[model samples]
Target: MSKLLVNEKEIVVPGETLATGMDNLPGNGTYRDGENIIASRLGLVQLEGRAIKLIPLAGRYIPKTGDTIICKVIDVSINGWRLDTNSPYSAMMSLKDATFDFIARGADLTQYYDLGDYAVGKIINVTSQKLVDVTMKGPGLRKLKGGRVVEVASNKVPRIIGKAGSMVSMIKDATGCNITVGQNGLVWIEGTPENEFLAIQTIRKIENESHLSGLTDKIKAYLEKAKKK
Candidate 1:
């Protein structure tokens, strides 16, 4: 006899009578009243077969046990390459983990990945202390080249990426740019001079106006105007 309503993607609220039944649950911005559930943020709605649930759109970038990310090789040693994960904590890529074979101890490890080389890889593990271990033995996870890196607020990343990459894809498709979003809020965009500028503008808009509701619609409108211009 209990009733639950889904207002947005990140939370679920109960109706008037149901609130009394759901008093124990925490508030995640999605709340319920007698009439309907209210959405606290903009996100995709998830239907749980028999129920409605909301998944938050914004969150901190906690390096998980198997998250794939783009990183920069900053240092090298007999052990491996030191990486900057866009977080306070850095990670290591053992030489054995670099690639197959015969890598001389130190004939200039830079030859292998050099300082400032960008690589996409997976987080093999993370210690409770936040020590991150990463590897590159996967598809489409390797060094990146010829692009400029930009950072956006971590909380705004989902809006910037959109559902199923539709938002990002539109920017890429219209501007003719190649872009990649790192979970750490780092975005890489490379393309013709004109396209790069357009992509940058789009991402900046997403960051600045993240608080506004109906962002997807706004973005579509913006892109349409741009197309006409």
Candidate 2:
């Protein structure tokens, strides 16, 4: 018979036994160890149809191609802009990738993206050397204005997003905030001062309590209270 060694949604540490027996399979964040499934990192346990996985509690963002991310403009160059991608490696958005508009060779580059600007962009490529090339030509990729940004554990981004985007949608509805969640953990919140704080608090709560069950209801209830206040 299949035996569960831990409760669903339980927070587990590295090397903790998650289950026993051969009836279950190890998925992400877990590994099989002599008839038992063990956690490979500190994360929340997720059990699904004989498959066990983990949602990591803390980790940095590893740049991946095709990931939509928030970036900060750090420097401008004759050819492109250097961006801080919240990762160990920096990213570049070449003039061709910056926009469709024709930019003369001698044109001022800062006119396109000034220093200290925030933008929503997509990762077009990541080289073996960990060099990241990003683009702003796609839809919804542009300089973000008038919003505050916050960072969270990058690996926890999936949890903050929740299933089918239910978690983020709930937060938006609750605080009436325009929130853009980057897969890299840079979140932009634009709304009234009151709503921005509410969104920030709610996101931090999710980041802290992601391993708990019934988190959707908890966030919803918290937002309801914030609305009433």
lDDT of all predictions = 0.72, 0.91
Q: Give candidate 1 misplaced runs (Cα > 4 Å).
A: 1-60, 100-107, 211-213
lDDT per residue for candidate 2 within 157-215, as digits (tens), equals 88789998999999988888999999999999999998999899999999999768899
Candidate 2 ranges with C-alpha deviation above 4 Å = 1-54
State every prediction's TM-score relative to the real structure. Answer: 0.72, 0.81
Residue-level error in angstroms, candidate 2, position 143: 1.0
**Model 1 scores what on Cα lDDT?**
0.72
lDDT by residue for model 1 (1-229), tens: 3444333343333222212234224244345554444455544456454344455565556676776777898887667899988777888887767766577745667777888998777889899999888887777677788978888876677778888988899888888888888777788889988778878998999899976888888887887788688
Best-fitting candidate, measured by lDDT? 2
Error of 1 at 121 (Å): 2.1
Global Cα RMSD, each model? 5.8, 3.3
